[model samples]
Every structure is written in C-alpha cells, then in structure tokens.
Target: MNTFITLAIVLIALSFVYTWGAAASRRVASQTGEKLHSRPPYYGLYLVLWCAIPAAIIFIVYSLITPTIETVIIQSYFPQEVLNDAAELANQTRQVESIAGGFGMFGEPAPYQVQAAAALKNVEWIGKMALVALIAVAAVAGTLVARTRISPEFRARNRIETAIEMLLITCSAIAVLTTVGIVLSVLGEAVRFFTFVNPIDFFLGTSWNPRFSTTGHGGQGDFGLLPLLWGTLMITIIAMIVAVPIGLMAAVYLSEYAGPKFRFVAKPMLEVLAGIPTIVYGIFAAFTVGPFLSTMGDAVGLDINATSAFTAGIVMGIMIIPFVSSLSDDIISQVPQSLRDGSYGLGATRSETIRRVILPAALPGIVGAFLLAVSRAIGETMIVVLAAGNSPVLTANPFEAVSTVTVTIVNQLTGDTDFASPQSLVAFALGLTLFVITLCLNVVAIYIVRKYREQYE
Candidate 1:
C-alpha cells in the first residue's frame, strides 16, 4: 500500500518537473524572439508540474490524516455506555473489531458465521475498489486541468515559478509539521506518565528507577532525571573528546594539506565511515573495544565492565568522524582564497595562515559541523544499545556500565506491559526530553552560524 502511494507521488512529482521545464523553455524562447530549441514535451512537463505538485501535496496530507479520521469515526459508533466502563469497553472493542474483521459488513455481522464472513469480504472489496476508482478519477482530472493551462499565451514561465514556489512552501511546511507531530505524540504519552509518577520525583530525584506495583502498597519507583542526564552527558562528552580532535585534524589535512591525487582517494574513504551501519559499529564496540578496554583495565588493576559507556562512546565517535570532517572540510575550503594569500604575503608560515586566517574565517561553519556531529552522537542508539550498561547509576567514571534514555525506551516498550502503564508511558517522557534538548542545541548551532556569518560579512 505504501509502495503504491509512493509511486503515485513520484510520478506526480516527475510530471510536474517535466511540465515546468517545458513551459519555461518555451517562455524563454518567446521572450528572446528565438524559436524554441526544445520540443512540446518540455511545455507538457511545465504543465504537468502545475497540475501534479499541488494535487500530490493534497494527497499526502489526506493520506496522513485519513487513518486517524477513520479510526475516530469507527470508534465513535460505540455507545458511551460501553466506553465509560473501562474493563467492559476494552473487551467489547476488541470483540467488535474481531467480529468486524471476520463476519461484519461495516459494523453489523450476519446471524450465521458463514454469511457474516462472506459479507465482510464483500464490504472490504467494495471499499478498496471505490477508493482506487476515486484516486484514478482525481489523477485524471488533475492531469487534464494542468494540460489545459499550457496554451501559447498561458505565461508558462510565471505558472512554473508559481508551482515551484508552492512546492518550496509545502516542503518547508512538512518539516514544521513533522516536528510538531513528534512533539505532540510524545507530550500526550508524557502526560500519562506524569499521572502515575509524581512530576517532582521525575524531575528532581537522584535515582532513576520507575517500577510501579498494582497492589498500591509496594515502594513507588524513583523517577530522578539527574542520573539519566548524567549518563547521557558523560557518554556525549567522551564521544566529543574522541571525535573532535581526530575529525578536525582530518579536515585540516584534507582541505589544506592533501595533494590532488591523495584527496581524490581519501575524501571518499572518509565518507565510507558514514556508510557503515550503526549496528556494525555497535558490534565493534561490544566485542572489539569492550574486550580491549577490559584487558587494559586488568593490566592496570582497575575494574571495567564488558559493557561500559566509554567503549560505546568512543566507538560512536569513530562513527561520526565523517560527519565532522566532511562538513568542516567543505567550510574550510570556502574560506576566501584572498584571506590565505594576504596571510602568506605577510610572510606567515602555511600553518600560521591556516590556523590564524583560514580557520577563523571558516569558524562558523566549523562550529555548525561540530554541533551537528554532537547531535548525531547524542541521539545515537545501536552502539550504546550493544555496549553501554543497562544500569542507570549516576557515575562520572567512564568505565562503569551506564544506561541512556534511548536504551531504557527500547527496554520498556518491548516488554509485555500494557501501553497505558506508567512503565511504558515513561518512554514518551524521555523521548520528549530528548527532543527538546536536541531542538535547543540545533537552535544554538544555527545562532552561532548566523553570528559568524555577520562577523565575516
């Protein structure tokens, strides 16, 4: 189903792009008083863009919203009497859904099981076929309307520009919508968590445990924010410690020092690091780095867990080196050649010029690169999942096993507990916290880049 929808969207986008290019070419030729070098197909492409881009956007919005709307409608048909009875409602809804799946036409099942099953199949077939027919009709209408606007006097250039503008607007809106949706979803879950666990305990407690008992007399779990925060910061700091120097030096070499032949080979090699699966990195951290650290710890007479934050963090840093170097190298290379020339003319050494002039000019972009790498490091999961300890102890020691919020989220949701349980809902609270922190970091990075731009400009 998703594949089909995606193919339709792709086809729509291609048609729009084609229509815009064709129309644009024709308009350009007319304005310049020259015969069009390109044929009518280009104009057709321009028209397709005008038709498909808006329609495709509408379709995407509909697709996302349609499921929720349908679910609400289906759920609404149940009586308030049933919905109000918590235990009864759960059972009734489950049974109704099962009956609907196996024996109903819409919400009504036949008296006999065989007749009911046949009715259910008939309902499904009719519904799906109707939907497909509607989509086909919509597509045909959209294409025809777009093609109609493609006559010689249609101002194809302006129409294409309008379509492009709409597309850009839609793309920007999608980014905002995605963020909003994630936050809202997480916020709803967090609210449920706050009901079972005290807000103060979750925020202020030192210990980070969250076990709740149904008997109402068992010790309520500690819900401290500090320990998890500490573990996350520690691992992030370790990762930065490893990644920053190596990535920066690699960037320096690639942008300022490497020969053309060496660069051609080396740049792609660095990018290869980015291509490696995080799971592979996780296994490396667990099996390779963990054992190496244990051996070193044993020789030094220091205890180290087989799965520690240090091993996970260092391995994660290695995973993010390409992000830092590639971005930094690009920014460094963009430092105006004149700045380097001026430094060299003053009899400064190559290193002096790079360190004083080029680096300073490129500082904003470099900072942005680092921040992006840091964000990647902080949100990283698999390496930590494989190597970082599951205990949420608040410890500064890198060799000790520690858990992150992401690890806890995975552990909680994968268990047998009901989704409404505080144990399960706490995942959302943690997710919300992570989202806010990352969002703030990104804002700061953007500000730094902007300020740097102003300084240089």
Candidate 2:
C-alpha cells in the first residue's frame, strides 16, 4: 500500500476508536452521576490528537532519514574504487536506485551495480514495512494512554488548542526559513562570482559582453552592470508613463463616476487583461507593435529599431494596467463615505471633491499600487526578451535595442556551461542585484505609504 493511503487508514481507524472512547466515558460519567469538565467532542479530539500526533512525528522522521540510511547501506556494498570520491559514489548510487525503480539505467550496469540494485529494492521494502509497523505500535500505545487519562477532570480543550497553536507557528516558521534559505544560497553564489569579477567593474562599468571560455581558457569579457540597469530603468520609465496615468484615471472613473451596473460589467472585463499570459504580450510586441513603431519612426525620419525598448515598454505597460487599476480602485473605494459627504456639504463639486478630498485620503494606497506596478515592470522578463532587441548598450534612447538584467541572467544560465565558470556564476550576481533593487524599492514605498497614512489617519 502507498504510504499516504496507509497513513489515511490509520488516522481514520484512530478517529473511530477515539469517538468510541469519548462515548464510553460520557456514559460512565452519566452512570456515576459525575459531570464532564469539557464537552464529549473535546474528549474525542484529545484521544485523536494523542493517537495521530506521535504517529505523524514518527512517519515524518522515518521518511526524512530513510534516504540517507539507504544511501549509506548501498555505498557499503560498493568496491573501494567506486567509493574513492563522494560525488562519483553519489552519482553511481542514483543510477543503481533509478534502475531498481525501473526508470532504466544510463548505461549497461556492471555485476556489482546489479547486485546493489537488488539490495536497494529489498532495503526499500523493508523500510516501508518497518515504518508501517512502528506507526501501528505508536497509534495503539497512544490510544491506550489517552483512554486511561480521559476522566471528567481532564482539560482536553486547552491541550488541543495548544497543539493547534504550535502547529500554526511551525507552518509560519517553515515559510520564513524557506525564504531565508533561498536568499542565503543566492548571496553565497554571488560572493563567489565577485571574487572573479571586481565588484566596482560589475557595478559601475558601462560595458557588458560575457564571452564563454574555450580551449581551456578563462572568461574574457566585460561584466559591467550599468548597461543592463540603464536598459531596465528606461523600459520601466516608459512602461510607467503608459500604465500609471491610464490605470489611475480608469480607476478613478470606475470607482467614483461609473454607475453600479456599468462597474459590475466593466471591472471583470478590464481585469481580464491581467489574466493574459505575458508571453502572448511578448508575441504581440514582437509581431505587431515593434514593426509599427519602426515604420512610424522611419516615416517621421527618426531611427527606430524593429525590436527596441519602446516596443517592450508599451506592451509591458499594457500588461501592468490591470494591476494598477484594480489596486487603486479598491483603495479609492475604501475611502470613508463621510469624507465625501463632508466635501459635498461644503458645496464642493464632484470633481473638486475627488481631486482634493478623496485623492489625498487615498494617496498612500495609490502610491503603493504604483510602486507595485513599477516592481512588476522591473521584474518582467518575457515581454522584454522578445521585443527588446537585447543589445547590451548604455544608451538612454527608448528607440534603440537594449537588454535587461533578467535577459542577461537568462542568457548566461540557459546553456550547458560550468557552474564554477564566471560566465554562469554571473547569473547569481545579477539575480542578487535585482533582488536588492526590488527590496529597496519596496522599503521606500512602505516608508512613504506609512508617512502619508499617519498624516491622514
């Protein structure tokens, strides 16, 4: 039986047993003319917790340790030659396990490998049987102990609530730990990259050309960051120019002016823009907007590449419109109606009231929405990748082709290059830099929003 199915069966059986225990205790209490401290359900829950929690802990610990133990047992069967290096041993062990699981071998298996595979299969079966047996024993012991302890005076509800609170804290801690782990991994790799390429050159140099090493040579190209940063900012500026005004105005109209019937129909339709895949936007930019801009620029006697920052910016802006509008609209709608009433009582017109009263009251949220849109624009990859011609240049022209940090990261990491090489390691540095930039932007946005919120509140 599958481990999950076995676990489910154990839990279900224990639930029934606990229910019976609760019912028997309640009947005993009634016959003895004694009152229970907590409800009958609390007693059932207490018994269920005792049965399930210990078994779950055992299952989790066994699952975590099983692979390491199996790997050690398999490695013990290998010859001294195969076990000379840890990396090679691990690779060979994976191959044995894959073949044992019927996933097919990478190449023809040796006699020793075939033996190891059989051993692995047998060990896995034994492990599963041992795990099931242990869980059964734990469940039976817990049920007995819980039944013995269940009396009219037991504080079952408090113990159950404490367990639940601890579970919630554990889940929250896992999320925080996972985020820290990712950031630390990226930061460590980036530090290794900086040892090869100077931090000053990476940050301040205007050039960016990462030539891969060939013929046992090292990397021989500029690893400047300014070009990518400039391109990113230029495209983001253009996108915000297109997105912010239109999105905010739309939000204002929808929230303050539109009738209920119109809002109900139109809001969903507008938000559908957010649902469209960004790759589709990239395709549209590459095919339609890019060519149109080039032709229009030629007609006007200006130089514009077919695939340029202008094309990507406009498309990305369209993609971000729903983000700004939806958030801003919600914020605008949340403004207290009493504020609007106060403005109206002062004989202020609708437009004046909206411009002066409603906008100021909702400014903090609107700023947060705009900053979020800007972050989204900065982090966008697909639209820029397809539409921007991807020239790593430090020019300020939107009509020129450019590349972003994300695009460069993709370029570096896509091919089969050595992770130890500067060519590939640069991707981690670029990712870290982008992360820091976004983090700073978020901090600034939060600070500004808080300042305004304090004033308004």
- Cα error, residue 456 of model 1, in Å, equals 1.6
lDDT of each: 0.78, 0.90
- Among all windows of 10 consecutive residues in model 2, the one with the lowest summed lDDT is 212-221
Best by lDDT: 2
What is the C-alpha lDDT profile of model 2 across 223-307, one tens digit per residue?
8999999999999999999999999999999999999999999999999999999999999999999999999999999998989
Relative to the true structure, candidate 2 reaches a TM of 0.91
Positional deviation of 259 in candidate 2, in angstroms?
Answer: 2.4
lDDT of 1 by residue, 38-82 (tens): 365656656565455555666677678665554444445556776
Tell me how far the alpha carbon of residue 331 in candidate 1 is from the true structure, in angstroms, after superposition. Answer: 1.0
Q: Model 1: how far is 410 from its true place, Å?
A: 1.2
